[model samples]
Target: MKKAEVVLIPIPAMGHIVALVEVAKLLVERDDRLSTTIFIMHPVLDPSTTKYTESLAASTLPDRMRVVNLPNLESNTEDTKDRNWLNSMIESQKPRVEEYVSKMRTQSQLSPDSPQLAGFIFDTFATGMKDVANGFGVPWYVFSASGAAFICSMFYLQALHDGEGVNLTEFKNSDALLEVPGLANPLPAKLLPSMVFREDLLAIFLEHARTLKETRSILVNTFLEFESYAVHSLSNGKNPPVYPVGPMVKHVADGRDLRSDESNKYRDIMEWLDDQPPSSVMFLCFGSWGSFCGKQVKEIACALEHCGHRFLWSLRKPSSQKGKIESPSDYLNFQEILPEGFLDRTLEIGKVIGWAPQVDILAHPAVGGFASHCGWNSILESVRFGVPVATWPLYAEQQFNAFQMVIDLGLAVEIKMDYWRDFLGDNEIIVSSDDIVKAIKHVMEEDSEVRKKVKEMSRISEKSLKDGGSSFSSLGRLIEDMIDNIS
Candidate 1:
């Protein structure tokens, strides 16, 4: 019997790429009949990123794994520039997919039969890869870098099939409750990701959702027990088979030791965290794509001051504006996006940096709560760290994720805004700043029952990732299913 040759394609970003590396390692250690190869795509690979990838590859079973680096097609250009993120993503992927297909074909020429490319594992944003896989007549599996709840939401295809279209504008006046077939709770239109409201992007997402049904399977980077509602919902119904194999960081659980001695950049953040009191610091971050206008930044700063908490805030310059270093007072140019005097007032208890070691910071004892944009990756990390969440959901599936945290799971408290109508582009709906203050206080303050509940939920989250746990069993089952299907 010939061993299978699996080609894994991972999107850029530390979190996105690591899961695939872990899965490849798992496949090699579990079976002698399987061999794996990794193909990485990104703008630039730094030494830190390279070391992390190499460590995973090297630590895995020898001789069964291979790592390949492909030229990044979009390296010369700015990712956050005016390029339509959706269209740019589709166009950029075409060349890379073509390149991979070309390489596979070339490999087949060297050996008459090169084990017939068993499968292609892709990141969530790599929708075009499915077409390439289909072209090559191989199985394609979407590897979600987030939680099961996030992917389950994508599988609800009734709205797409009903010809309702993917625009939120269409559902603006719709008060009708939507029954997501496999979810534990009814999904309100307000809870959907902001992108779902945009007809063009929504169409693209729905198309991907449709493709999910046609693909080999959907693999989520999560454990079964952590999101049982979502996992079960996606599994039992008309939805495609869902595989939960996660907390992928288990392979890199050794902490700061994973950071190579060559660059001490990560050392500064880790050292600062060591001095803070246990569960006293608030960890604030928006993922790589998350940015705020200067006005919103000021308001957040004001809120942080009012909360009186020691916090580490990750502040990236606003991507909407380029080559400008405007202060919080530059409200006129930034369109009231941030609150005034936010920085001057909060300097005492807050340390703001461009980026921070999020996972390491969260796992630190001093970190008590997270104020986040509610990205699924951030949410999962928060849960793993046993930190409570103060939800400030932004675009994409963040709104849905925030809603699920606050309303469905009761694991987080939602920050309110008085200008909800202004922010939402809906004049009728009103939200207030008082809501924000209250929610933040509830999550950060020790007296609040909600804070206690989050701590308990955190423990449950930790248990799911342990050996022989729900997540562990699910991963084993997923590997078995893949092997069985191939054989």
Candidate 2:
């Protein structure tokens, strides 16, 4: 039997790269005839992302898998707020990718032992590679790091603007609900992604949605049981085939953890959790980019003290640089931002730290609930561990994910559905301590319906990965389709 290789192109961010690589690993494990090569496009500002790629390249991969780092391109990320920065950065890499893949094709043609190119699998933002796949005459797929509902919402947004001539910017302040396919409830206009407020961002976003129609398939990092309505809606043959082959979270049981290193502080966190009682602690972590102004930090401090729950908070200092994707860093002194006497008063009941072993902590018995930014990966991780989330979305498509959890799925309690971070200043409304306290209490309630729902879904999420389950079957179909397209 002839062997084949699939090329993977993921955005340089940690979250995107990790998810797509899991898909590659699964593909190779499931079929002996398949192999994968992940092309890493380095991010401009974050050294952490580049470092992660280095570690992955150094690690022992499966028999037929490899990670290739493309040559670094010097680029400016100073105007990151302009919305054109990401699109421009991704577009600029086209020549490098084309040249590399063109060379791979030539090498395969010369050697009979080399694996033939099977297909191109790209992260949704990297869809600019469509033309290269076209030139090479191979099928290309778009892998959504988000859920199926997000993809459906993207399609709906594009249709509303181009087909119906609806002005999307109006949704920023309008008290209207958006009725779209795939969601069980009518989506509040305010919960739409922040990109809708700006024409420049919206144009780039809609272009990606439009490009999905031209792909061979869309592979979402969600399971069928998780997003049945959205998956079924997209599979109606009007769009390309949609495959839900995930809930692709790290298996803590497999000894893989997301902690940065084996430092004493990281070790102390897990040890502290071990001392606490089961389902007693509220774990608060925003994603890598999540941070807040001093005033907001104080409000969260007030709530944590008032609620008096056993808490583990991963608090990061906001980056001082303006208009850049530089990730927030750890504060040297917690006293500078936190309220006076707050730390002393709650010292025994709470533990505040920078960065977290999120997968490890969630898997621990002591974690009762998660106060989260509702990043799709975080949502999946929380669900996998049966940890109910108190949604406090910061930006991007997180507000939509929060809404889906609270309104459509009834799987989480709401903190605030539409919280957009203002990197310029604190223009957004402040979420009061009272609201935070309320959400924490609701999520931690032992008999709460949301908690029950999450526990049940956790079982389903696990089952979906077993031999004959939903995600397992979807993955099988995706592999079969890719093999069938081999020329």
Best by TM-score: 2
- Model 1: lDDT equals 0.65
Model 2: per-residue lDDT, tens digit, 408-440? 999999998888887665546789999999999
Clashes of 1: 13
Supply candidate 2's per-residue lDDT for 292.
89
| Superposed Cα deviation of residue 356, candidate 2 (Å) | 1.3
Among all candidates shown, the one with the greatest lDDT = 2
For residues 32-67, could you state the per-residue lDDT of candidate 1 as single tens digits? 766777776545323346556667656643566777
Q: Give all candidate RMSDs, comma-separated.
A: 5.6, 1.8
Once fitted onto the true fold, the runs of candidate 2 whose alpha carbons sit more than 4 angstroms away are 76-78, 254-261, 322-325
Model 1, position 252, has a per-residue lDDT of: 26
